[model samples]
Target: MFAIERLNKIKELLLAQKRVDVYELSEKFSVTEVTIRRDLDKLEQKGFLVKTYGGAVLNDKLNSLPNASSGDTEQKFVEEKRMIGKIAAQMIEDGEAVFLSAGSTCLEIARNIKGKKITVLTNDLAIGLELKDAPGVKTIVIGGDLIPLSTMLVGGFALQMLKGIYVNKAFLGVKGAQLDSGYTVSHYEEAMILQEVARISSEIIIVADYSKFNVKGFARLGDLTMAKKVITNTQLPNEYKKYYFEQAVKLFTTFDFR
Candidate 1:
């Protein structure tokens, strides 16, 4: 294929996948890695993509990709998150303090709870705002540097605040969950605060949809073993059931819970 045709194909892939690595592109196009890098450079210069360490991501100006914790992300896995959220909220006992991590799934958990007198500590600005009218639920925000994309407060300030309190459970979210890296998120600062939240909580429960499986992120929060339980949709593949059992992590699926 011609150079122009290959470059156009790469752009199409980026639009669909949001990100792509040089190695994969090279193999897919039957070209050298150096050739792929040159194509990426051209794309970046044209303001179509932003080149990362070994990959390229869609440029914000060119693609209106939704924020990670925004409504769009919420809608992507609506039914799955709703099921996981309800099951996760059920894990909380009445009047128990809990840490609700920032994400679409975590927000669903917050929305599903009713008539529960609980103290909710969260770094998500949206979660804190939603709990204001939750009747019987007291919401506290962990103040720090706010990340606009995810609406999460990270950095040292948030970490210190979380350390001062212990909760019954922490319902955490992640960009991906892989057998090797466990739970992972996109940003390093976010991962740091999430790690601390998991540390202080007695039970670390990961609430994710089936889509998150096998996807790896830029930063890993902790190993899968850190989770006491995992709440997911009924669609969780059967192949992963044995892994969760071996890790001694309890799995709650909508199939059984819902």
Candidate 2:
């Protein structure tokens, strides 16, 4: 395999097992021990792992560990999330009716919708609060059982609120995006509500950071074709870029820090 592909495989192994033996990796990749050691040394310098006596361990201190909860997940991808939100927000035209799903990135989208006359239907309590002070924007909060840490509402009550209302666009945030099983969120209830949102919207725009790619969550939302566009940062892998492009799904990337 090529060096970049080998490096990615090593990362995937470290993510799944938390540690990797040099001998095992060398055998698995069919390369010499010297070459595997060199790869580990480079990954160590990039803060992806730590070299040990005979192997390497995933760098927990560098965010290589899995997140414990949605709250932790939201806080970990701050920069990419904010940029994704900014790009998604710019797609909105004045007076459009939009559905903003519940997540940190969706909250950022709500925060960035400045000086626009729009109607926002959202289950996220935090997003409602953020839009309360913005002029010419009508914020509708879908009511149900509140998921406190995520500041969102879900379940039958929220589903009832969405009935019969069609939207111009739906901006959704998901826990993961997969090539086969498709977009998913951590909670089944949230996934159900998101499905309803997708049903009523004429257009779907998924707002997610690059970290979410190739990951699968507990509940499947929809297939990849459900979304017309995806807003994310430039860190998306070339493989995914080619896949999305081939699928005719438009991708918008924001690489800017500001």
Candidate 3:
């Protein structure tokens, strides 16, 4: 495997298992013990993991991505995500068809969607569970391989289902947002599904918090040109504002709670 691919697998293992042994990782990735040690050192420097005598442990820092099962990061930025969700909810009109992407922010947007005579398509199991029984709102859950960490379905089945239908608007979530990279996710499969969703939506709205700005992830979703508008918190840097304007991407900010 390539160096980047190996690094990503190491990250996935660390995130999923919370700890990884150097010898075990060497055998799993088919690399030498020295190479595994080097990988651990690099990951530790990136703040993704902490080195131990025989292995590495996942980091608990707020700036680092939390372990998949921890769910702490989602709860940490709850209010900021809710504010972004409220603004995104306003964009939906009654009786319109909408697609909601998976993420903490988009999950809040699904909850904030009020009395709307609309059909909602989503791969997020959480969003489906929240809006499934709501009166007058039609909810369709896309079926495919389940990503346990994100609790979303993405793969051949989901992509095929999306091909048969289109939406008036789509609300997306990102692991990072850069002027050059557009939006990104931590995994390749998720990025592929997101790109397909963006292609079939009439208007693509990205719901991300200010912390996402300038962050880099493992995979690229698309560039800024793909989004019609980006809804985020007011703390977004002025440099990003200038870049988005130049790229013809409209910027929408929610009220500052801080």
Candidate 4:
């Protein structure tokens, strides 16, 4: 992997997990301890962390801010997400309403949406704000309890808002994905809401990076069967690629689009 990509992932891990060990990062990226230290040093110089005895801790200044958490999520796989977002945005036709689920990748989709006259329903505060000023886009945020650590809105209030309407397409993001587990997230309440949305939508499109592949989370919403298409990075393994194909799922890679 490129240095910038690895750096972004390390930053992401530190922000999410609070700390990062030199050895663990080395092993995770298949690099040497010396290389990991250099990476940490670079982060340190940029005020992202404080180097400890054997690892680095996320900056104290960043820990208490919700914005920091969301920013870090966007740091990883940025190019891939941007490409996926661009391609996903292109898939939407004029006057077709769509649902934009909450996540870093889904936020990218919101960012890349073009000048189409369409209504947008989303449970993400970030997505709502992103499209607030866009021309020819009408955005609606679902009513729900806000998750403390991020901007996601979920639960019964969100579900009730979707009762009478169906969207042409729903773009979703997943915390983990496996053939067995399908698409999952850490929160059960959010899972319930997303599952309902998936059921009501005519077509489901998942936007995720390779890091989510084979990972399992606490709660699942929809499976590969429910997802009509998946937009992801080229870093995904051929094994998973073949697996999606066997399931009759259309997989669009960022590298292919570029």
Can you give the TM-score per candidate against the true fold? 0.73, 0.70, 0.72, 0.75
lDDT of 4 by residue, 170-246 (tens): 99888778888788886798898888888889999988888888766667776767786998888887888988889
Q: Candidate 3: lDDT of 116?
A: 76
Residue 12 Cα positional deviation in candidate 4, in Å, after optimal superposition: 2.7
> Could you give candidate 2's per-residue lDDT for residues 1-258 as a string of tens digits?
899989887876565335677776775677999999999999999988889877887787744345622243344456667888888888999989999998778988998995899999999888999999998898899999986334779999999999989999999998778788898886789999999999999999999888778777768899877897999878888887998999999999886645
What is the overall TM-score of model 3 with all chains considered together? 0.72
Instruction: Show where candidate 4 strays beyond 4 Å.
Output: 1-11, 14-76
lDDT of 3 at 31: 86
Kindly provide the TM-score of model 1 when superposed on the true structure, using C-alpha atoms.
Answer: 0.73
Error of 1 at 144 (Å): 0.6
Residue 166 local lDDT, model 1 = 92
* 1-258 per-residue lDDT for model 3 (tens digits): 997878877775555445667766665567898999998889889888888887777877722533343245434456677888888888899989999987678888888884778999998898999997778789999999986434779899888898867899999888777877677776688898889888888889988888778766567888867787999987899998888898788999876434
> Ten residues in a row with the worst lDDT in model 1?
67-76
True-structure RMSD for candidate 4: 7.0
